[model samples]
Target: MKSKLSFLLLSLLFYHYANAQTAPGFKELLDSAMVRDADLKAQQTRNKLTVLDQHKLKDVYLPTLEVSGMASYLNATARVISPELNLQPFLNIPEGKYNNNINVSGFSGLAKADAKMLLYSGGKVRQLNKALEEKRQSENILLEKTSDEVAAVISRAYDQLALVHQSKKVLDEAKRRLDANRKTADKALGYGLITPYDHKKIELAQATLDSKMAEYEGKKELLLTQLEVLTGIDKERLRLIEPVLVPVALPAPQKTIDQRAEIRALDHGINASGFKIKAEQTWWIPKVQLMAASYYIGLYGARVKSSDNIIPPIPAIGYPGRKLDWKPTNLNIFPMLTAGVGFKWEIFDGREGKHAIETARIDRELLQNQKYDAMRKLTLNQANNQSNYNIANSQIALKKKEKEMANNALVQAEKEFRYGMSKSTQLIEAENDLEAAELDYQNAIFNQRRAAVEVMRSTQELDITKLY
Candidate 1:
């Protein structure tokens, strides 16, 4: 019966194995997954946005150019080339009167070009550039943060996989022992050396073993799926290399929070806010621009001749020789040229600019306070993780000791039962106690591993560059 049950269990294992998925190790799976991980992709996207934002700052300091044209016919306007209006003081007397003359009907056309390049904005551009650099640095820190988180998750998953495998191995050994014990009981019962109750107790213990095996199998499947999610590897690509059981070293109590990424981000934020304050204060100063431009003017206008509105008369005495032919004017094109510099002194804005600078100053202070706040939080969290890790390590050691003693007691029980000196119930109880102790030890190890991973996450020292 023992052989038959072993054959059946082996067959089931083989069937499951044939259908089970295979996976690569944590590092290899992470390598494949980093390409597809959404968190990494988001961080990369943020980095690109930061780059674009930095490039956009250049436009604030660069030149602006524009072109335009205006054409209109007026019922009354001035002539451009009138001698009196030409800035010749002696030609400024009447008709061609003020160097230009008013006509009851005329038109004018203009093509204008203008350019302005800022020579100075009172350090606004410089301050903004500084702020942008800070922003970029902060984003970079966030990238590191994401990478660390990914590494920690992979670590935890690998730990779980290891624990399951180890526990499963221990359970397999227990199962084999129970099967052998049941065989001995069966032989003794048939020889009338033991009661049927003893045989039944042995069978019950074996059944417990089978139940535990089934539970381990289910747990293994669940663990595999969880690992798959963490690494982002497809079902086929993920494998777990034997995980290292290296002990974690406790962090020194004297380590400060300055090296942490959260604190760094806070520092950058403070710097960025300082620059923001400078940028706002720059708005109170004068702005100077250098400008030069040239353009072509083309005029097109038509006054439909209303010759029918002309009244023919016979007033001949005033100008009998003045019946001259009327002349027609045509549109002409000409070149327009210009050059200049401009200055704007914003002497006052009803205190708006002052308030703006004041507001920015307040914001700078706010960021400083936030930085301190973040520093406190970061230090607390790191300390807590360190403490947890140390506690878990101690717990693992203690549980390992407990399991050792339990195993020794169980060994003695088994030996006594092999002779005629021990109750089947007492032996089974000792055996169960050993299994429970082993389970507790395995759990402690798993917890210790999880805490160690958390420590790495807190320190931002997890190997996350591969996620890039």
Candidate 2:
């Protein structure tokens, strides 16, 4: 008895585990899709880029240091001439041979380093930083928007899969009813109570149900494939459970619109544009900076040559020319250091700044217009979605009642046909009506759930964490 009880307990546990593995809840599907969605990943990357841009902007006011070095060969030649004078008696030099030519050549090297820090920019830097910060905020909003969009898509797909699952159940039941009717018809024909034509009609009804079942199977496969692609989950393992059907309360249109990610992103964009305009307008104001620089200059392998034609020429004696040569030497100069404050003001830029300011203003205006248009459209969407939810909610009740009536009618018709009191055609009609009613009821539930998702999305309340 103990062994039997343990086996029974194990069997129950296994059954529960199998069910859990097959049927994924709506929130679980959403979580998986959020992780697997390519668009959301790309948007997340873009948001990271905006964060880097903000960090770059933060460094703009910091001092910038630069070091540079240069090396090159230098050559120079010069000639100097003095007023004509007779120097033969004083210095014993010939007048015509006096030549003053000089040459210098060397390799020169220079190294320079400078640092500059902005002291004042007429608030341009501040405005630019603010604009970048706003841009980052806008990017964050876009990320949120992308996430919401992904979640909405996943919700709809999950709802579709659930609908298909429910639909297949309806079709299966219909097929079973047709099969039972076919058996009954066959027995009646054997007893000569029903004609062969009526038996064939039953077979035809069975065939039609089989066709519909096949069609629903195809639809289920397609929906499963879509879900697999979206959530990166294997279709074979995915069996979706029906999502909860509940209507969301509608908030004020303007209030909801203001909370929407798109509207908030546009607002951020407008603020960014305004900041950019202010930054552009500051182009006329002088920008002051603290500048410091150091320079080093050195010369190596330097040589100097000089020649003078001051020796008198004598025909009977040999005379050498007067020339002087200086050996190569290295020359180093002390490093030069300087620090000062400077300001730059653009007096004119061919109206570039003006045009930039105008462009920024236009961008701000465009965003404003977009926000206004979005508000109008979102208001309409909110109203429509609320109405749809209400309609679907009403339809659910009506469809449920209709389904109950159809089920009752099918039971009555089956019993009548079994007793040879009703025709096979009436039984078939009853079965079809029940199938249609069941499908309609399920569809109403799906529609209501989908409408609720849309309402949450429009209000920027469709957070996966919250939903899960």
Candidate 3:
């Protein structure tokens, strides 16, 4: 029988431990948010766009080819007047036999292919490519920044939920204490040692405790809804565990600020702007290219008309009306090939290039200024967070002591009332003190955790690995 009892006890302990381990904690929730957060996903898409832009810039230096075809019909007639006896002396033809009159008609078609390869662009292509590369780097940095922001938001929400959970525990304990006291008061009233009003006071205290618990529950529901939206998780499945408080350590303030993703992104922005300026400055330089083409042309269904006297009435010629017909496939130019070098220079463009160069320069200057301002602000924020963390740590120590003292006072009050040496009101006040102290301690812990988050965020070190 003893062995069976021991085995059952051990099994129960193991089951409880397993459930605790299975509950999702701060790190797990943060990981889920990182994957599901809509803002982070949007930033990732923007990064992909930058990558595509880079590819487009790379293809600008490669050759381009085009092919085309055309078909049409042509018809025409002409009349000419000249000296009448042009061939009489040479061929003994009759005078006035030759007259000038011409007529023609035809149909034709054409096909062509052209290719061009860029040889030079006065270094503009190189500059633009470099600028695009810098832009890609900046986008990657922004992605890191977005991830950090999401993590910070998840941390705050988790902290708030933990606070609510801790408050509920305190309230429950207070209710239990009140119930035990009520039972003792009932015995005292039966012995005619206490008044009925004292018993009624205990009931009122229970009612107030119920109200506070209801308030905390409402807060928890709202927080769970927020987590559902941020993490794309069902509220029913989100099991929150209390976070363990640990000491936070950090490096020198200036060094930490320098490593921030925002700072790095700004640096890339400045570099990209500089490259753009260079690209615009080279606009006056002409672009050089190698060009080549091949054309195929064919004419078909050709016919000719002329005066009848020009060709004496020969019986061998069977055609009438002095008309001649040509075969549909008689005319063709199989390959007309051409190759040459070409250049394009914009000598004047209403100062467009000049304005573009100035605009890029202004952007670079703005980024530089913003970098300076950001550095200053980051330094100040780091200092403030550090100070807040220290204050919260101190408050935790003080509140812990206060809670211990309040618990001792409550124990003494309970004993005094049972012995008929004190009133029920004294016991109730002690219970309230202990509950208040417990909540204050929990709040202190939460504040410290929140401060730690802000500090790590400023340093860009708020990843799951470091946070845990």
lDDT leader: 3
TM-score of 2: 0.83
Best by TM-score: 2
TM-score of each: 0.78, 0.83, 0.82
Q: Model 3 off-target regions past 4 Å?
A: 1-21, 76-104, 232-237, 240-254, 304-330, 463-467
lDDT score at residue 15, model 1, on the 0-100 scale: 75
Q: Candidate 1: where is the Cα deviation over 4 Å?
A: 1-23, 68-113, 237-240, 244-246, 250-255, 295-297, 304-329, 456-468
**What is candidate 3's TM-score against the reference?**
0.82
Model 3 lDDT tens row, 1-468: 999999999999998777555667666688889999888888888788888888887887799999999988866665555533364555564565445555555787899999999899899889988988998888888888888888889877877887888788889889888889989999998998788888787888889899998999899899989988887766766654555544445445444788888899899899999999999999899999999999998777866655444444434345332333334544889899999999999999899999999999999999999999999999999889889988988988999999999999999999999998888899889989999999888888888878877877788877455556
lDDT of 1 by residue, 227-334 (tens): 677665555544434554444554443336677787788788789888988888877688888988877643344342222212222234342222112334655555
Scored by CA lDDT, what does every candidate get?
Answer: 0.71, 0.81, 0.81
Residue-level lDDT of model 2, residues 1-468, one tens digit each, is: 999999999999999778657867666677888898888888888778778877887787899999999999988988866523455675555555555777778999999999999889889888988998898888888888887788788877766776777787788788777878888888888988778887888888888877887888898788888988888776756744554433334444344668988899898899999999999999899989999999998889998776664333444456454465776578887679999999998999899999999999999999999999999999999888778878878888899999999999999999999989878888888888998899888888888777767767777777444333
The pairs that clash in candidate 3 are: none
Which structure is stronger by lDDT: 1 or 2? 2
Which regions of candidate 2 deviate over 4 angstroms? 1-23, 79-101, 240-255, 307-324, 463-468
Candidate 2 RMSD to the correct structure: 6.0
